[model samples]
Structure formats: structure tokens, C-alpha cells
Target: MASSGFCSLGPTVTSLFSSHALARWRSSSISPPPLRISRALSAATTVPISSSFTWDDVIETGREEYTPHNSSDLTGFLEKVNRCNRASEKLAEFIPFVIEEQIVGYIHKGFTEYLREFHDIFTFSQNGSCPDRVDGFVTLNLMLEKPEDRTRAVADVIKILGDKGIIPGIRNELYPVKPSFNAPVFFSLERAAAPYFGIKGYGVHMNGYVERDGQKFLWIGKRSLSKSTYPGMLDHLVAGGLPHGISCGENLEKECEEEAGISKAIAYRAIAVGAVSYMDIDQYCFKRDVLFCYDLELPEDFVPKNQDGEVESFKLIPVAQVANVIRKTSFFKANCSLVIIDFLFRHGYLLISPTISLSKETSYLRLYIPDFNALTLKNLLVLDLVMMII
Candidate 1:
């Protein structure tokens, strides 16, 4: 009886195995259906992807598709300023103010009342209802007899504005008064009103970077919450505006000490990479400024200590994360974004992809570097060399 039962079980097991094998063969013979291309993808093939980006993308217009709180504000401000400039017509209608042969500022016909009120401070070439624009400029003779006189004049202007409540208060910071971008300093002006007059300002920004385990990191500083402008905003490791009577190198060293507590020996190691320039205009002021950028590689053991109360804290962030912040957030000071973008380009982090347009790349390469015309041929050559080295 046992032998008969074993024989019956063997036949049942063999039948089940044959059915499973047949199912596996059928499954193996069937292939995955071809993937269907959607209409959207088919349309995408006709449009070429952009390979290049321009300075307008990141610097001028701010990044697209990620509108920060200030993006619209900046755009609106620029639009208003441009519209005001366009409404004014021929050169004769506008008052051209020259500094050492170049027209730096223009006073609109609307500001005639203010000009008349301050006529004592101005020396006109002719005396009449309307003075002829000399060489396309109605030069305002700021009868600055002495250096101290210029200071007093600037102070008096501030006082007049403050008395009328046009300006809230006077900031003690003094800015070098240049006729144009790189013209020699004619006098000093109050920092608060410098942009209001369309004066060109200079500043220095130091890029402090570290290498750890084959990755690059940047040393970023956060402005103190109590600071007046862009309070609590992110800043470069060391940055300061060029005050009157100080050279760029000297100002850089001083800022390194004051802002980051770096000794002169170490701070002087910073290499001048390049400069970034931009013109920002709003209802209140017009800012045409340039930042002299430097690259400094710090040792792994080195840490920054803020000597001035302006900085709240220091942080070491990876370069990738820093780029993300610039692209997605308005945490950084307006000009600081340009400096970081310059650093990324110099360090090869920002590259020209195959889809980027050649024209766009060329436009970015021609960054609005202020004072390029002011640079001597030799100096320009040297600058090109330094940029190549970067």
C-alpha cells in the first residue's frame, strides 16, 4: 500500500513542476512594452536648451523662478529709474556735472529749485537765467578752498537735509568723492548721501576659503542684528568700503583686522582676483559701485574671530550650499551676491555648459567692471593677467 501511495505522489509532483516551468517560459518570452513619448517631451526636442547664462541672470535681474522678497523691489526700482532717465531728452535740457573731463552726474530740470537754493556753493561759468552748458556740462564750482572747506560743505549739506528731515541722521562714515569711476579723489562726501548724488563708491571683499578632505568651503560672516543696513544679513568674511585717504591695500588690511581679526601678515597674502561693478537705482538713491575682490586660502586650523561688533558670527559653509543660498534666498547683502558669483566663476564652480549661448557667456565675461577706462594700458594688461591666473 505504501509503494502505491509513493507512486501516486511522484506523478502529482511532476505534473505541478511541468505547469510551473511552462508559466516561466511564457513570462520569459514577453518583453517590456516600448516606453511611450509624451507630447511635451516630443515638443521639447524641437527647442534647444540654453547652455550659457549671463550676468543679467544672477547679478542684474536676480535668479529667475525663485523670487525673493527683494527681487521685485529691485526690479521696480530699476524700472522707475530707467523711465526717469528716458523721459529727459537732449543733453541741453539736462545739467551735466563733470569731474576731470568725464560727465559723472546729471541734475534733472526738476532739481532747478535745489540748485538755486545752493547757488552760493556753486560757481557757474556764466551769469544768466540759464548758463550755457560748457563742453556739454554746467560744471558746479564747489568753491572748495581747502580740504577742510570741502568737509564743512558736506557737513552743512547734511545738516540742511537733516533739519528739513529729508535725511534721518548723519552717518559719520566718510566716502572718497571721485568725479567719476576712477578719477582722482576731488573731495570727501558723507557716505549716506553719496549714492544720492550718483557718486561712484569703492569697496573691498575678501573670499576666505578652506579645503577639507578634497572639498572646498567658504568662511561666511553674518552681520550683527543691530547693524543699520541689511541687518543680520550674510557678508563676506572681510569687507569694507574705501574711506577717504586710504589706499585699497591699506583698507583691505584694516578691514581684515577689524572684521575678521586676521593679522597683517596673513591678510596681505590675499590675492586680488578681480572686480565686480553694478549700478543700482531706486526712488531714493542711485548707486554705481565697484568691489575689489580678493581670494584667500586659509589653513584648516585657522578660525576667524570678529574684532568689530558689526559681525554677529562666523560660519564655514560648503561652496555648493553657499551657491544655493545666493540662488534661492535674499539672505545676502545685495552686493555680496555679486562677489560670491565672481568667486564661483573664478574658482571654476560656475561653468559654461554646452547649452549655454556663446553670446550670453560673452556678456558675462564683460562684467560691469567699473573704472576699466580709468585703468592704464599696462594696468589693464596686469589685471587681465591676474584674472587668467585665477
Candidate 2:
């Protein structure tokens, strides 16, 4: 599972003038007004947005001039990868959340104080000496052994917490709780509280692109400013959390139609390319997410319209320009950065030498299927190696 950070760099502008304009300005007896120079300077600098930078505004300013080739900007890409994986030092603050002797999540020592209030639902065990070690584990009451019972008991506690604003933005959607993706569901947890409980979450993110005149253009969505999270940021054409009771493919197809108005016929064409994982700790939230990635090629004539109001607008941007926007600005939602980077690697747009040394500070891992047609098996292997190094 991977996470991300948000950064925004303001607009950039580059100015060119005909000899006539230059001569006119030079010959002017009156000084060129200060406002004109100020406006010109503003146009030359990138305009930053609330969550990210605008691609079209920055692209025209020749922001990519620093690294003409996208492949040569590994350092910028690494910055993005680093933002998604953070706060490893705080891992000791959390204890395992176990069910049936199998650990399913982590609970922060601070947040566990709330769980202590619900003795009927949670049981705490002390098994180690060190205070900061994973010396203790939290479990469901043994009497509530059945999945249904456990789920209800947990749901009641979540409601109390939600009322207290401890767990804000409760989506009412259910997310499965288990040891792994394929494991049988032990119970279901409210989607918003999953992070607070340190539960491993999953989501699907798809890159919708069009191959036009030998160049690839990606459909990028501008998230609605009213969104609870990452409002007004750039996002993939389609993305959503992996709610309970749905396969990844099915979830992606549903999200594709809802988020971008793509029909099932086109959504089904999305190839499951790979997955990215990361663990992030911020205060009481321990976000461990694994995002399944997909790439769908759309017809040149297709223009996406959001059926759901989650998206405010959409634009088709050249893949190379998109790479610049990501590397140079924090306009894309952080987790979306990982998926797009994976897309770049698969499409031969990102070139990283195997011998390049990765510092220990970077924490991210990507697993790929060897046979994905988006790239040759060997290329995927090499790309996986590069991701592993980071």
C-alpha cells in the first residue's frame, strides 16, 4: 500500500517579443509601467493552486527546460515517491490488532485508550517487557467469535467515536478486515476508521489514456473543491476505495463509469498492470494501502464526463507534460503519484538505471505481474528491480 504528500508551485511564464514591441518599449520616453513588468514576472513564474499546480499554465512557461527528457528527472520523481512513504519512526507507537491469532491491523497506544472504554468489544493483552515494543495486542471479545457479532460490536463502538468526532468523515461504506487481500473476511469496518485502526486498506486507480499521432495523452481529472480529502487536486481518470464485497476488477469498472462515465465495454479493457504499497503514520492514523493499478486505452474521440460530482473537470494532457507536472509540482494527489509513476515506467517514459543507488530514506515497494502486455516481461522485471531499490 502506498500513500502520498501534496505540494503546489505557482504558475510559470516565458515571454517572447517581436523586434517591433521591443523597439517600441526601448524607444519609449516614458518608462515601461511597473505594472507591466510585474504582470510579466507573474506570468513567468508558476501559479500554485490549493492542492496542486496547473499543467497547462506551467507547461507553456517551459518549466520542463530544466530536465528536457523526462527520463533524466529521477531526482524529482524520487521526491514524489519519498512523500508517500513517511513516519516509519512512529511504528513503535502502535500494537498489533489480531483476530483468530492472526494480526490484521495496528492500534496506536494513544487511540487504544478509546478502545479500552469498550471492554465488551476489545480485549488487550500484555506480552512483553519493553514499553514501546509491540509488547501488547488488541483483539475482539472471544464471546463475539462469529464475524457478524464482531462486526456489529465494532460498528457500535465506531458510532460512539464518530459522535465524538474521533473518527470524522464516516463514509458508511464497509471495508473488509482480514490478514491479507485474499483472506476470508473476519468482519467489516467503516471506511473512514480503517486508517485510525491501522488497518490495511486497498483501492483501485486507473490511467485512462489515448494514443494520438504516435503520442500518448492521459485523461486527468480535477477533483471537486468540495471534496473532503485532497479537494481541487489532480487525480486519475478513475479511482476509488476497494469497499467490501467487490472484486478489484468489478470495483474498477464501477468506479470507471461513475467517476468518468466510461461504459463497461471500455472499462473492461483496463489491464491490471501492477500494485503499489506504502505504510504512513500521521498522528493516530496508520495508513497502510495497496493500490491496484490499471491502464485503459481510450479512443481519440472519447471525451470523459463525470457522472459523479466528485470530479469538477477533465483534460487530456500529453503524457510527457503530465510527467513534468508531477515532478515539478505537487498537483496530483500523493498516492496518485505512485500509480502514474508506475504507468511511466511501464510505458517506457521513465528510464532509471539499475545501478543508481537509492538512499535508505525512501520507503516504497511495487510488485508487478511478469506477463502484463503493457511492457515486456523483462522490462517489468527491470522496473520492479528499480522500484524495489527505492
Candidate 3:
């Protein structure tokens, strides 16, 4: 659980006017963008957690567990519910709190079921306040799905959270399973960039947070990206995630070409790859096992033509213009809109900086590199320079 503060910093652009290169992104270009924004704001921090404990073990202690592809997992889950009520009965303190229990106790005193719940408590609780009262327990969404293969369920949860922010942005939600995974063995098979410690393989992605006329426009998607767990459905502005790694730099070029419809030149022109968020999509929250954010910017007129039907349409909405629309919009489908927005607002491109404009600024940065004037024969990271270490 973390704070909801959106920010980003990458190549900046000033002009919001149309560009010749961006002619194909209008409503008449192809089909309209069909994405919606997500409303959930609490950041879902996917820490590595394991819920390998079983019902038997939980009954002994106040803990629960779920094993992948196991029938007993369900029985154990139910037992947790029973235990919640038992906890209330056993303790005279903190009994029958929250709206649900209050109503339940009033309606039926001898309850047959337990409303067991789990939450990742934040320093400041869900309402953004450190609870002055220790007697009250927090309530969260039940979020249940019909029985399915463990892998399938995990994917569904990822889609659900990504598309609709089903998981609260900053709240502590229960981890039904432990978080763990082997980095795809295939990842280490790549050959290029291997000299740069652990660069056996690499992946690529882009984060497009745009602003127009002093108002930020979060491009959203209405359709679930194709080849995704939720196949052909509504989702976030940045729908793509965790692409397979190809050659060291080749993967980024391919992803931008395929997903964002940007030329390789433009992709190179606007690369801002960096580590942004901590995620455990595989076991903790669901979807691609892990992902890091990359930032990309272009002329305001740049419109993406999704080739694979992954993105149905795009909607450009005002930045501060979010509330019910986040939940209501289909484009901000990746439940991470708040996360994305927080990142953008905090570290997003500096369009109108202290003195410079975005394009001119980018031009300067592209041509300039850290000076080689430093007295260093051992500076190995200095690109394009062959220095002899004495």
C-alpha cells in the first residue's frame, strides 16, 4: 500500500496543434478509440507474499492459505470465514463492528457464517486517516469469481484490476496466494547486450501521458487489448504490458511499432525507459508476471493506429478531469490509471519548464551527452568512447 501521487518526466512537447505526421489519429482516421479510464486510486503494491498455508494450518492459527490448482483451497477459504466469526465470539473486545456485522447482529444474532476479511493496513487507513479508534475493523470488497483453472483465475484478476481498478490503489488487499516465480528462462537466452551485466534479454514498452492547452489528456482505450486474458474488452489508455523480449534493443522497437504505430525512428527519438513500479502480477495481483514502465512522448497530434485490434479506440480527456469518469470511462481500463496519473503528475514531461520548450529541449538533449572532459581513463560507461585503463 502506497500514496496516490501521479507524476512522470520524459521528452516534452509544447504545441497541442495538429501535425502532418499525426493526420491519421482523428475520428475520421480509422475507428474511434473505445477505451475507458479506471477509477480505483489506491496503489496496489505487489509485494512478494505467499499464502501456502492450508485450512488445517489456518484453523490452528489465525492465518489462511490457498494452493494453486488444489481443491482443498476452497474448503480452507470457507474455514477462514467461519474463523472470523469465531474470533468475534471468543473476544469480548472489538466484537460485531463495521456496518455488515452491526446489521447482521441486529438481524440474526447466532450467525452461521463468518465474514473473514484481510487488508494491507496503511499507516493512514483507507479513508486516509490513521484510525484514532482501534476498535473498528476495516471492510473490503469480497471480489469472488467462479471456479476456474488457477492460471486462468490469476489472469482474470489481472485483467479485472487493470481494466477497472478492482484492486484499490493504496489499500492493503488480501493475497490469496504467495508471490513467487522463476524469471522466464527464455529471457536469459538472448545474445545482445549480454556484456552489460544481466542483459541476456530485454523488453520494451511506452507510457503516453499527454497534455493539451494546459489541460492533460489521458488517452484511454475502450476495448480490452487482443491476446490478453480478457480478450477484446474495454481497458486503460496504456493497454499493453510485459512484451516478450527479443534482441536487446529490438524488442522496444517492435513493441512501439506494433502497439503505438510509431516509426522506429520516432521510437528511438522518444525513449524514456526506467523502473517505475514494483509489481508481482504473476502470483500476487495477477496478469503478466512483472512489468516496468517506460515513458514516450510525441507531437500532440500523434495518434496510434493499433494494428492487432488490441486497442479499439482512444479518448483524450482532461487531466484533472477525473472522478466518476475514472470508474465510468472504458479507456483508462488498466486499473493503474491513478498509479499512472500519480507518476505523471509527479515526474511527467516538463513541457513549459523554467526557460525551454519541449521540442527545442529534446533537440538539445539528443545532441548533447555528458562531457568526456572528466579526467578519467577508467570511465567505462561513457558511450562511444574507447578509454584505456592504465
Candidate 4:
């Protein structure tokens, strides 16, 4: 049994993105004045989060466990979901980024100023040129018709932005630009610039579990401190961004080999378990991400080794303890929490009562596990599960 009292949670979860901070984000509108006049282009300023908590605090919170409660008691999972889907009301600050009559993404109004310099490559259609076009939309120049041309032209612009430090942390990786997961690729963009363009980014996150004596345990990895994003945070056993020209299965297999030393044979047995999508708007960057989730039942004796320098360490923790870590602490990387919560829900580790209210803004997790007969299809959609957290 787990502890009934959530000692470590305190103000950490509520204060992560407090309402007061959100008010400031709302007030700091970077929408340029409605004049055709020109202003000097500069890098967009980042939104400041007013929180005193640090990553070390998050780590410390993960180490502690509450006592005297049922092992299946889960009240704090909703907080994890809230962390992933944030600043959605700030969506008004962005404008539709259309390409070939298709709305491919959204660019922040503040970031749009930077693109105004490259008139040949970017077209700002604010005059309602087409009937379907929204007011004040951005699109690529029609002259660069071919995907190759658009890619090269955008690459040149990204280079300039990278040099100016407007778009920092260039990973040198290419992410396919499209309206949806299955949509035709418009072109390839630098991975770092995806959020700035508000493109729908996709990634694969796999939960590798071991079934030992009818009990289940999960393989969790601590990200290396040297990582550019979410360093020193917990992560999925095998996870990677879906770069251009690679299938989700291929990317997951590659990540499994590189991150966890899993062979192709073992990786091949991993099942596609569905996906979770979240939309977050932060300052000049709007992140609309969809993560495809997978589950792999690993042999109990199969230990994971980090072939790449990305993961700091790996641990085989019981799934229930892992849930407590997520429910009580902000230790897991924001998106990873969603995948893990989905796993818990599907496995019957967390009981779902019908009294909870589902929020529209929450990231919707879709489960595709065929044999799991716990929740009905309609219930899965609503996710109206009760929370025992308070």
C-alpha cells in the first residue's frame, strides 16, 4: 500500500504554471501594431515563468513516497496531464501559417516580424486574399513551388536565424513539415525551428516493461545532464523524435538500439499502443506535438545499457512506485508523463471511477491495446476517472 498523505506534492504541482503567471503571459501580447510601417527585426523574447522551484527540487521530490494508502490510489495523475497541455489560451497570439491552401502550422505574431525581412520566401497574407484564408496569415512564396526549393530557401533562412541566435539549439536534424501525421510532406525544416513555426511535431515513446512472477516493472531512464532539453529528468526507456523520411517503427527501433541496447528482434516484438497529443503555447513558440506510444514486454533478466551518451542511468522500478513518482513529483519530462499515465490506465493499475470531470484542454491519450478489456471505448474517450488526490 502507498501513503495516503501526499507530503512531497505541497505547492509544487499547482505552482508549476500558476494562474498568476498565466495572467502575465496573457498580458504580454506581442501582436505588432496594425500599421504597414516597418520595425527593426530582432529575436523574440522568451516568456518568463514565475516559479522558485528548480530541477533539483523536482528530483528530491521523486525520491520520497507517501505512506498508509492503497497501492492503486491515484489522485495526482491529472496534474501530470496539466503540465503537458499548458498556455492554450495564449493561442490567440499566433496566426495561421498556410501553405498551398493548407494550414500547415501557426507562427507567433511576435516571431512573424522576423520573417518579414525575407519577403521572397515568406508571404504575409493579412488582406484576406483568399475566401478561406484567415485574417493575418503567413505563407511561403508560391514561386518556390517544388518541395526541394522550399526546403533550401527555408534552410538558408534558418541558418541566418541560427546565427542571430533567434532560433537557438540547432540540432542539425530535419523534421517533416505537414498539416497532420499522414499528410503529404510540404518540406523539411530544422528540428529546433519546428516549435517556432508551430508545426505539429511527432515522436515515439515506448514503455518497456518486465513481467516477473505475475508482477510488472518498468524500465525508466534518467536523461543525461548534458542534454539540451529536460536534462536530469526521467524519460521513457526508448524514445526519439520522428525525423524526416523515417517511419515511426524504424525510429523506435533505432532509439531502442541506441538508447537501451535492445536488438532488432526484441524491438520488433514491441506493440503500437496508440498516441497522445498536446497543444501548448509559450511566448513566441507554439508546440503542437503528437507522441505515438508503444509497449514492449521485456525479459526480466534483460538489463538496459546506454549505447549513446544521452541517458545518465537506467532503473527497473515497480510500475506502482513509478506512478507515485509521477503523481508526487515533477520529475518526468512533461510529455513522458502522458505516455506513462496512458500505460497505467490501460494496465488496470489505476482504477477509474465515473465521478471525475474531464477537461477539454487535457491531452487526449488514445489506447490501442486490443486485449485490454478493462475500459469500454466510450469511457476511454471521456476518461471520466475519479481522482483520490485531494
Candidate 5:
């Protein structure tokens, strides 16, 4: 069995045959972030809702199916990846896994090809105390130009995903996104090893909610476009796994202060929320997550604020508004929007699943399949790679 159920790989998904990971682990000399006092105040302060990290997701709206490709970027990426040093822990850890082992073999081959092609442009290394890092690249969040970013982004994505499937979907809810096939997706990455496999990351993204009306409005923070990841866009309430310095709960409070600039009390309005994902990469890799969510019984006089400049505008959107955004294709990225929409519907926030019925499924998986067609798949491959790499 893998180390974390969240990871998607297994035994057949062998870590690169590099024995480098066998090296001894010097206790990470890096210092963790200091505990902040603001969290205590956040637990008590409750007013208007603020952004959250737990509420982002992957958008597979218009794709038809997953297809393989032979591209220069992918081959280049693999070639560089061919060299790396991981510790015993990582060597013994999990590697990317899929039901179809053949796909894995093909993907491995494709990426190696790209690595050789881009030999001069990129560098590959798998030197870590952990094993999965042997074949994986560090997750980085980059920004893009406006809607036309697709032209510029496509090339970058190919370099990241390689032969792996780089899924794409609608960015907005209005339905007809730029491609018209998918909704102009903004978030996607190379699929990772599942969670139970011991594969993890350092980004912050937790599952949380916003309280509005009598019901608990699912609240996710929108990422500032200035963010290295989804800059100038709206995303989950708490994002980028709380930066290692704080707990998931504390991170929520920080987001309130940073994203919406909500009062301290607003951060602590704890409600009965479900699984919370601590980082955006986690959300992107492992679909399910956990976090804190509660109705902030703040006086109606609550006015939200955002210090991070992420919230150019905030509104109390009904759970359905998320779907409308996807259907209308108005949202800039698909995963976070899809997450909010799926959470709402799955957790009974929507008319169908307004209250966690357990008989629901997120539309993201089904929706993205069609949009992932051949031509679109080709484009998606390019975009998805960029989604994974620089």
C-alpha cells in the first residue's frame, strides 16, 4: 500500500531507480514559521466572511478523454528528471500511479524525450530526503496575461506535464468559454501520487466556508493576480497550505486579514465543516480535503476587507452562482470555481445537495472529459504542462 491514500501512485509506479534517496537525512535545518497570536483573536473574532484556502479545485469541463502525446517539451522534461538524488524515505515512498500501467510507461518515455530535446533549456534533479520528488518537479505558481494568456501559457504547460494528461476545462460559468469546448481553465497540473502514499507539498489550501444568510455560505478566498500562482484571479478562501508557520485554522485567520481584511472575530466563526485541504497543490492532486467552516454570527454591520489585493470585488454568491459562473464561463480558473460549485452541490449548498446528502458527485470529472478531446487534448496538453511547470 502507498503511504498516503491521497497519493495516486503505487508499487508499479516505481520511484526512479536512483539510489540517491538512500542518503541519510540531516534533520531539516530549516526553521518553521513562528506561531502567531492573531490566531487566538481569529478564533474569537467573527463577523463577515473572508477568503479561504480550502475551497479551490481542478476544472475538467469540456474535455472528452485523456490522450497521450509526443512533444519536445515533455521529452525534455523527462530527460532532466532522469537525474536526481532522493533519501531512503523518498525511495521507499510512493511514485505516480494510474490504473493503466501502460500509460505510465508511455508518459515516462514521452517526458524523457522532451528532456533530451530541451537539454539546454531545463535542468532536472531529484535530490531529496523523500522519494516521490525523484520523478516530480517542485510545484510553482505563476501568473499570466489576461484572457489571451492561452497563447503564451500553452508553451509553458507542455514543458511541465510532458506525456502526462494535462486536463483543461471552462474558466467561467457562463458556458461558452474561449475554446467553447472547455471553459477557459486557469488551474491544472501534472497529476500527483495519491495522498496515502506519503507524497506531500508545502503549499497552503484548506477546506473552509463563508457564512451568509441563515445557511453557511461556502466561502473560499480568491487568489490575488499578484500571487505567483493565480495572480489577479479569485480562488478559495484559504490557499497555498498555510506556509508551514501556522496551523490550518490559523491560516484561515491570516487569509481573512490578508485577502478580505475581515475582522479577527470573522476568522473564528467556526462551523461544522468537513475535510480540509491545507494547500492548493494538495487540492489539485487529491480531490478531497478537510478544513474549518462555521457561520460567523457577526452583526450585520460586517464589511469585508482584503490586504493582499486579491479581492478586487467580493460578493455573497449563492452556491448556484458557482455553477452559473462555470456554465456562463465567467470564472477565470476552473478548479477553485469547480470546487465551490461541487462543494455547494455535494454538501447541500445547492438545491440538489444543499446539506451533505452523500449521494452526490462533483461535475468537474464528467464535465472535463468531453472538453479534453483530441485537438483540444493537444491544446490541453500544452496548457496543462504549463499549468504544471513555468
Candidate 6:
């Protein structure tokens, strides 16, 4: 939905990398040149260089045309799967519950069985349906008796699902159940069940990048092959879910320390950038998750040591090479690609051309920001421009 006006600026802006930086990047042999490099270096002579840059630069240097890469694969992965088939349509049978007219979570049609199985912890409409029929469509609701009882009820549900083998890879982690992102928590749910019930999940992703010899290098990790999800795939330096009762900052610091052995003081220096959201639906589950993104600049001498067994190894790769890996191979977790793309755009590595159609840009931006209902045409164009840059 990006505007044509903003999209037209693609060819006007100059290169984001200065001649000196480009020289170092090329010398490193991390990736091939994106465009034909002119021998002229006069344009870059007056540009100031600094390791400590601001987001204002991202906003300022927002015009350029970039050569395309294999980023289309990410677009295809995020396109909404057709649900017109009977099996997929069955997901519509569950109705979402609204509190203060905002969607909280869905109540499965079979929730009556749960009410009967755990009558002490659930309350259902006497008519077997909601009274209002619009705002109150859910047939069953969790009885919020006490703060402590909420965890107990979630435990019971986890036990029931475990016994039936309904949920996979239960991590024993707890996720808060709220009416909305800013709403008060009414109860808690097991991490695995959150997707099954279409609940919102939160997580954090920290990008560890460094400037060495005037070139940008990123620290990338390989997930352990034994991981239940995306095993052996590339991942950010430090990432983890926001568990129940923990703030985003706290969860990020914890993950930084645990996953990459970053000290608390160093981890606190990470800059909280923004968030990316997506809703993924498969045959048996639905996930509407959001990741809070952070960028941490590491010292040239710092070497990341994985304390958690989840990471197999770490590699220091140039930014362009990282972009190529994301574009050419399915080596990264699907969602991690979004985070990296965001970083690329924010840092001025990616730029979109005006020649590409709006539809193509829309498809690509959807991968990073799945829920684009509220995005304006200008915003969509900006994101599309960013993706096209990659």
C-alpha cells in the first residue's frame, strides 16, 4: 500500500557506503558488488565517517535504486496460504473473544469439552453460546479466580495436552494471556498452546554487528542441529521469547547473557529499535507473534562464546555476505529473515528502485510485517523500498 510518490525517489539518492568503506568491503571479498562500481571516488571524499551513527541517517539517505537478489523467496514464504479447503476452513469454527472491543484470543468450538473436563477452572454461557452474540462470541472463558490459580489452570491444560500428544515441543515456558498487547494479563498458557489458540507471543532479537577496518561485520550463530525448530539454521547473535512475568528488556538481557555470554552491562547498551509481527498458519497451528528488535555494536576484540547448547557455532560475516546468505539459501529461520531485513534497511544497506511495481513490494513487505492492515501506502512503500534494496 505504499504511495507512488515515495517509491519514485529510488533513483535520486547516492550510495550509502562511502568510497573508503566500499574499498574495505570489496577487499574483504565478503560479497560481490551490488552495482557496477564507477572508478570516480570524488563524491565520497566530503562524506563524514563515524562508528557512532544515528537513525537519522537511515531516514535521510532514503533514496536509491538497488539490484535485486533472491529476497523473493521470503515473500513467497509469507504469503497467506489458501484456506478455502475444508480442513483449513475448520479453523474458522473457533471464535475470537473480545474484551473492550479488542480481540484477545479465540475459543475453539470444542471448548465445551474442556469446560466439562475442568469445570472448576472454566465458566461457560448457559445457552452454550455467548449472550451478546457479537462481542461475546466465545462459549467458554477461563475463570480468573486468583493470580496463583491462573498458573495452576495453565499447568492443568498443559498436562491434558501432553497426555493427548496434542502439542509438540513443549518448552515448559509460560506465556501471558492478555486481552490485548497493553491489557492486563488474565491468565497464562503453555508456550506450545499459544499458537494452537491463536494467542499473541512476544520475543526479542539482538543483532550483533561490528565495524572493522571501516567495514561492517555481523556475528551470526548456527542453531544446534538437535533443536526442535529450524535446526542447524542461521540465527541472530542472541534471541529468546519473552516469558511470562518478564519485561522485554529483562528477557533480552537474559538471552544475551545466556546465549552469547554477553555481560549485563554490555547487554544493556543494546539499542531497542522496533518490532516485526507475523501470523503464520499451518495445518494444525496458528501463530501471531511479534519480535522486539535490538541492535548491539560489539567491540572488534570481542569474540562471542555460546554458553547455551542451543547454538552450535558463531561466524563473523560481512553485511553483504549475510544479505546474500539470506537471499540465496534457506539457511535462516523464516522469521529471523525479517529481523535481518529490517536491520539492513535501517542501516542503509538496502534500497528500492522506482521501477518495481507496488504489488511486488507489497508481497515482499508482507513477509516482515505480516499484519499490514493499519499501514499506510507511504509506510508500505518505505518497507517495500527497503526489501527491494536487499
Candidate with the greatest TM-score versus the true structure: 2
* Off by more than 4 A, model 3: 1-205, 224-228, 231-249, 277-289, 322-335, 347-390
Candidate 5 — which residues are off by over 4 angstroms? 1-199, 202-223, 276-299, 330-332, 351-390
lDDT of each: 0.54, 0.70, 0.29, 0.69, 0.31, 0.56
Clashes of 2: 17
Q: How do all models score by TM-score?
A: 0.65, 0.80, 0.35, 0.77, 0.37, 0.67
Model 2, position 6, has a per-residue lDDT of 11
What is residue 193's positional error in candidate 6, in angstroms? Answer: 1.2
As a whole number from 0 to 100, the lDDT of residue 232 in candidate 2 is: 85
Model 2: per-residue lDDT, tens digit, 276-373? 76666789998888777788899999999998799989988888888887767778888897788878776766644443333333343444333333
Of candidate 4, the 10-residue stretch with the lowest lDDT total is 5-14
Candidate 5 to truth, TM: 0.37
lDDT (Cα, tens digit) per residue for candidate 5, span 66-151:
11221112222121111111122232232332111111111232333433444443333344423334454321123433433522
Which candidate number has the best lDDT?
2
Better of 2 and 5 by TM-score: 2
Worst 10 residues of 1 by lDDT: 37-46
Candidate 3's displacement at residue 336, Å, is 3.8
List residue ranges in candidate 2 displaced over 4 A: 1-49, 52-73, 128-134, 356-359, 370-384, 387-390
Error of 5 at 224 (Å): 3.5
Error of 5 at 134 (Å): 15
Of 3 and 4, which scores higher on TM-score?
A: 4
Q: Indicate whether candidate 2 or candidate 3 has the larger lDDT.
A: 2
Better candidate number, 1 or 4, judged by lDDT: 4
Clashing pairs in 6: 1-377, 2-377, 2-381, 3-377, 351-389
On TM-score, the stronger of 4 and 6 is 4
Q: List model 6 lDDT by residue over 1-390, tens digit each.
A: 321110110111111112242244334422222321101100001111122322232223222222235344333223211110113234455555443334556555565354357666554443424322432343234455564676686578767877788676888888987754555776678887787666777788989999988878889888887888777767899998888887777887889888899988888778655556555446545566767677899989889998879998787877766766554445566678678866775675554443433331122222222112332111211122222324
